[model samples]
Target chain A: MVEIATIVLILVGTFLMFVAGLGITRMPDLFLRMSATTKVSTLGMGAVMLAVVIYFDDLVATFHAIAIILFVFISAPVAAHVIGRAAYFTGVPLWEGTIVDELRGHYDLRTHQLESVPLPELEEHLPDVQVLKVLLPATSPLAGQTLAQINMRRRYDVTVLAIRRGDRMITNPGGDAQIQPADELILIGKSAKLDEVVSILRGLAR
Target chain B: MTPVQGLVVFVAFPLLTIAVILAFVRLVRGPSLPDRVVALDLISTLMIGIIAVYAIATDEPVLLDLAIVLALISFLGTVAFAHYLERRV
Candidate 1:
């Protein structure tokens, strides 16, 4: 009777492990693969360890097997979360159908750290709007052209108050003042608009 | 040999071997780094199962110690790799 039971447990455990392996191969995305793998493998190993306890039928062996089961049960989901968070932060693209990305726009590009608070939009009740200083990279389309050519006010709804170029500050520069490769523009606008301007200045599409 | 022992020696080991191979294929072909890491995590989990079964099949109960070591260390490995990924990238 114990022999039959042990055989069944071993089969079940190995079968589930096989299924998990199949899942990791067949799943479309990284998150999906992880979702399939982490939990299933835990159960599979748990069953296998239980079989070990039963088959050995010794106090020491049972204790060790149960310890393994407990350890695996605790660690699998946590490791999955760690890998997923790391992947998301390191520019891993999600599947197209993914919805409700709560972490978007919460990462600080400067520090590469997740912000506790989401990027704040200026309050409508306040009379003052947010101001940000943006640096345009050399590859930026707006780098070689004047502010007039880019239609800064019309397209972006942002004003460039001052241009700081290599210790030379041009205060409220004229429309025809061409931008150079390494100019820092002091911008005044809504936070979202400023973000848009900053992204574009940094040569990002969106 | 008893039927259960024969079944484990013959059937369980082969199925687990095939499982390991499948995970290995994913590890090799995983498109992104994290995908490979996920695969690595799965492979290690399967290894735990294999080691447990092997311990009993050989009747060497002390080998369960290796499974214990694997479980703790594999978790640490995954966390450390994740920490490396975000900071370095």
Candidate 2:
């Protein structure tokens, strides 16, 4: 019975490893490949190690296998995240099928760090109207849709003065301009209208 | 070893070996650098699995020591590669 169980474990582990190989070879882009290799292969190795523990039935071998499983579980996801971040910051093009880019302009290429959106300087003496920088997340419905189509002016009463994307700024974007995921829309309006725009972008209705 | 254990090892070793070779194919393609790194990481993990299978087939507990060291070293190598990918090293 133990032998059968071991064999089953080993077979399933090998199949998972094979699937990970297939995923790496067949996935369209680097990020997707990372997604495949990190989780699938780590789990495969864990299963194979479990089989070893069951087969040998020795304390030392089991300890070693457990240690390896712990290390793999801890490191694999972190490695994938770092690799994905590097690919993004280095401007590796996304696959054409990708509909959203969550980190497009949010990272610094040289430092390999995230760029914080600068909060507008709030001064009571200056003016009542405020300039708000609105960041669009990848899940935002506005993504892949043009500003003209959304008609933010009619919906939220806020004007999109400029759009900041990956170190380039588009001032006074025309009607044809498209709003991409992670785009920072520089809006100028009353604070109440800006609040409404924020809610809308967050996928919430007023 | 029993007949069932022997047969299991015989079947599993070849399958794992094929998986390793497939991962190697991905390593060589390298449409991008991170892809290559990921493939390398997969290869190392696969090697750990292979070593574990060997220990099981041979019934040698000592071999598990080598597997442990290999696993730890591969993790360190992966972390270093991640650092390199981030341009930190």
Candidate 3:
């Protein structure tokens, strides 16, 4: 009786595992693959564990099987999350069919604001300008200087919205902020003056 | 019940474990990190099945403890791998 049960369990488990393997290979994107494997594999293995516990009829072994099932249940999603986050940070392009990119939308909205003004005062209200992104080149003249020394806002009429160093972001940096090489700078100001500011910063590097 | 029943419980289950191991090998050889992680997780689950089979075949209840330990270790390993992949560790 136990033997028959074991065989059945094994067959089922193997089938599930096979599906997981298929999903990994067939899925179009990392996230989709993760969804497929984590869910199916966890359940498949859990069933296999249960079958083993029944076959053995040993309290210790049963507990162990239960423990393993619990472990799989808790960890699979976490592993998927890690892999997804890593892929995102590395700039892996999402599958073409993806409909909504919440992260990109949020980032764009944060950096650019939309406002409504009365048409009667349309001429009085200055048009909103596009923001620009600039990288602090290795040879940039501002590389070793602090914000106070650079006087970037006064000189270029541009506001440094954020500074990204490696993976970390420094928001609303102070005047004493020391610029480092290879730091990505996000600036916002009038679009017409963007070239002028870029030129000035690039000139400093020379 | 019967000796044959006992044989099936012990022998058949172990054979299944062997199959699981074979699948695990494929997982390890997979081309991506997520594939590897998935395979490692499957192996851990198979280990639990093996322990349960041993306990029933031997009529030893203590094997459950080992199964529990295996489960915990597998969970930790998965979490660690995830964190490492995310570069958060």
- TM-score of chain A, every prediction, order shown: 0.59, 0.58, 0.52
After superposing candidate 3 on the true structure, give the runs of residues whose Cα lies further than 4 Å from its correct spot.
A1-10, A53-58, A92-206, B1-34, B50-66
Q: Is candidate 1 or 2 superior in TM-score?
A: 1
Return the TM-score for each candidate structure. Answer: 0.71, 0.69, 0.52
Scoring model 3 with DockQ, what do you get? 0.28
For B9-67, candidate 1 gives per-residue lDDT tens digits of 89888888888898899999979999888888888888888888877778899999999
User: Where does candidate 3 chain A have its weakest 10-residue lDDT segment?
Assistant: A105-114
Q: What digit string (tens of lDDT, one per residue) describes model 3 on residues A17-53?
A: 6566566656666667667767876777776777766
lDDT of each: 0.82, 0.77, 0.64
Give native contacts recovered, as a fraction, per prediction.
Answer: 0.94, 0.64, 0.33
TM-score of 1: 0.71
Task: Please give the C-alpha DockQ score of model 2.
Answer: 0.48
TM-score-sorted candidate list, best first = 1, 2, 3
Ordered from best to worst DockQ, the candidate numbers read 1, 2, 3
